[model samples]
Target: MFKEVLQQLGVKQNQSSAYHPQSQGALERFHQTLKSLLRAYCVELKGDWEEGLPWLMLAAREVVQDSLGFSPNQLVFGHKVRGPLALLHDGLKEVSDPPQGLLQYVEGFRRRLFLAGQMAKENLLNKQKKMKRLFDRNTESRVFCPGDQVLALLPLPTSPFCAKFLGPYTVVRQVSEQNYLISTPERKRHSQLCHVNLLKPFYSRFSESEKAPAAVAIASSVTEMAEDVKVPEDGILQPRLNNSETLKKLDEFVKHLPFKQRDELSSLISDFPMLFSDSPSRTNVIEHDIDVGDAKPIRQHFYRVSLEKQRHLESEIKYMIENNIAKPSFSSWASPCLLVGKPDGTYRFCTDYRKLNNITKPDSFPLPRMEDCVDAVGSALYVSKFDLLKGYWQVPLTTRAQEIASFITPSGLYSYSVMSFG
Candidate 1:
């Protein structure tokens, strides 16, 4: 029945030797782990195992497997499954607004899935290397050149008094590393190719006396290999500092900086490594409160854009929508968008909020003067500074403020979730 099913699917069946389950070691190990997990999850009765199986499977898929270095769901679906704990941690709310159209939603998911597949493939390769390193720690390379006489350990059962070693077989050729074709004394090819682990050097003079001991040594070596693989001395491999790719990249980047700047950066970073990050910091919430002070809402006329500017503005709107910086709005207030050209030949998306600012009263609290600020900083023993990528946009606006800050565009009316400069 299985063969018929495979034939229907056009898959060739290659069964491993049942006598040596180690041939399918990976699957066997997985089965063993699954049984252990099932046992832990099903603390009740063996008959109640079916009730907890689904939950156990979900937990298993969500966890990072040792061999793959990723959760099964992540590898298959290209994203981590959000559990109840994850939702709770994220405040039981969506991080960003969903795409406006069905087509856009599908495209976004597809793009993320493709990226996830690439990431999972890289992680799998790294994990395979790590596993191989531990497995090959005490393993020595063995090559059987043609014409080398070796004894093959057969799978046949024998009595306590009978000889276990098969024969002084001559190695015909090395089929591959760890596998060799063998022939009997009569130069007839053996039915099965012998693995290196079950083959030993055959001495003609001491053939009878040494055969048992040679077989014993081969068996012990195979057993040791299995033991070492199953239980590595080090549970987790530690990365070497000298072989760090990140440090190498950092060194290359530092070489491009000015001499004094590099020295100052090195000293500062060496003292405060956590201050450095590959990505910019995120602003999760608003840091200040703004009072419109009973200022009436202002609605500005729609700004005109050329055919080229329309496409650029549309692209910028898409970016803002995707990043959750802005969303589609239908509010009483509206401002016109102004495309300001930069010195670098790029356009900055801005809003004409001059009319709105004129009506809104300014905060009475004043900031410290330049001299006073300089004197206050001079008293400090150590000082460090960093710039926010988009300072104004980092400050989130209130829901009411967002409606009041609505802007008109060719695409539609939109409101900023964060504060924007005029």
Candidate 2:
């Protein structure tokens, strides 16, 4: 049925033998990227990987392939996708509407795709040749007889201390050129046939008197078995600053600050001593007012919590109270808090404001366009960028707004004194 479907599409299926993932080069490469992206997202979001799937797909298509010199999206569309940067630079003009007439558009698109395919194919061939040259540079070639002793490297657990390449397993027979069937000591067939790259010739100088485990003759490092893992010519690894070194640099930087600026910075530290705490800054609070107007207060019950998370939530509430960021409340409005994992491996306390936002009137104030802001900096001799620390919490909220933003917790009901992240 699969072959029939391919025939219908005027394409012939080229099937290779199973169990050799390296043969499907493109798919294997994509799988590597997919795994890496998913792992990163899962780590950052604490297993909320589903939320990152769309981003993963977008990132994959936008990334330029090393061999093709073009992103998957670009090759298919015959142009790069208009991302945020592009849209910011050129406004709506960055993504113009397609040609009106369907037939004419199809012909144009077809021509563009054909040209792109030709270019991609040529580029891929050149890249393959270059890669092959580099690969052969340090690769040691060795042929084995039918009964030769060899060790086959197999996939193992992903631990730094775990052995990556294992086996003093015997070579069963030569399946094809540079390919061999391997087996155990009892002559049982191995899991799969291995390529020449996976097999290292096992040389025995002494008489066959020594008996060792399969992992005994394994390579010390990946570089010993693979040509790609080469050390730098300088042989010196880059120096990473220790904690003390980092502190010393910061102290040195502080020493260079102007007297007036130092005084101003010191004033902020003195005024907002509690700002160093995890809770909101007490200096200037921004109360979030739910202008329910005539609508009734929307109160939500506290959600079920895990023991570990409940403890964290309690600790976070205490931290906020100690810093004067939050206080006990009897407000009619209430919301739930979600514990999200931050990149730093700490949990960020987030409130679910969806219920409130749904009934609230949308703010229509337009933000300045990125293009205009960037253009305003034209031909400047020197430019400076400043990031406000805890900018949202710096704005104080009204007393009424605080009550409207109350949330229920395991310990008790509480409300923010300053603006909170939702």
Candidate 3:
């Protein structure tokens, strides 16, 4: 059936020799890992594995591979998949203005991909060299030259043992380290590529007793080649918090402040760095409550989300739970959430509260206008501006408001413990 489909689609089907999965060892290893993940996720139950396969794939893609030192997603996409936690961490980074057009964006993406792929390739090569050295340890290399007689391990047609060393075939040439090309019958072409492990020295009965293991001259050379690939062991680099670096940047920022207030503000920031933390801060001073004023609760089903979007949503939900910003809820009011894409390629999580908003009672209290604030501040000696990080999150939510702001996703229903944008 597959062959017919391939033929119909004009696709050529090139397959490797049967029972030789080692030809594509990397693919086989991937299959093994994927199966292990699926089996573990099932918790010993066998059926319905496909249901969790997408999530398992996302998990695997996000994980850093030992050989490459990078997650597959990062190597391919030039960045790690971002959610709420990643978005918050991104704030700590100094980002430049993004490219202006499609061509510029493509150029930027191309540069990133090239750099990431080159680094990944270098890391993979380093790991391969280390593994090769470890594998060659204590193992002898059988170096063969052209015209050497050697017994090649071959599969038997019918015997107690499935295979036997049947050849005293002449060596065609040396390929690399322990691998060689062998002269074989036309029908035996497929098995002619032999490793040192599969070939043994062919000796006459008289010389069998006196012959030494393959040649010491070339064997030491192979070992030396293996050792030549040794790289210096790298130290584990732990990420240290650089308060000094933060303060240095802060000092640069405060240089723009008024001469008299600069020192006092700098001292305050140095003393209480926690006030400007990247993480959200909440206050007990104000607990906001949403009043529907006798209107019916709004319960809307979640919108359909793509697998990629769902993966991000799942990550955002996990972050919210860990930070105590949101929790599982059984609220009667349920609103759907949307992931709005930002210009910088990140997403903004928002709850669809239009239905709830229509029923919400509006506050009628009057407040001073911006003109009045400017007029009042005109008489002051100094004017300063304050900006809060995650301003909406700084305010707490009332218990009743939490239930009223519940939103649903594929994972389940959750409600915010603080104010959230719609």
TM-score of each: 0.37, 0.39, 0.38
Q: Write the per-residue lDDT of candidate 3 for residues 50-82, one digit (tens) a residue.
A: 988887788788788988888888887887776
**Would you list the clashing residue pairs of candidate 2?**
285-395, 285-396, 285-397, 286-395, 286-396, 286-397, 287-397
Top candidate (TM-score):
2
Candidate 2 lDDT, 275-298, residue by residue in tens:
443333445223345566666788
- Candidate 2 local lDDT, residue 36: 93
- Clashes (backbone N, CA, C under 3 Å), per candidate, total 0, 7, 0
Estimate the overall C-alpha local distance difference test score of candidate 1.
0.73
Candidates 2 and 3, the one with greater TM-score: 2
Q: Candidate 2: lDDT over CA atoms?
A: 0.73
- Worst lDDT 10-window in candidate 2: 219-228
Q: How many residue pairs in model 2 have overlapping backbones?
A: 7
- The number of the candidate with the highest lDDT is 3
Stronger candidate by TM-score (1 vs 2): 2
- In model 3, the runs with Cα more than 4 Å from the true position are 1-265, 341-345, 378-382
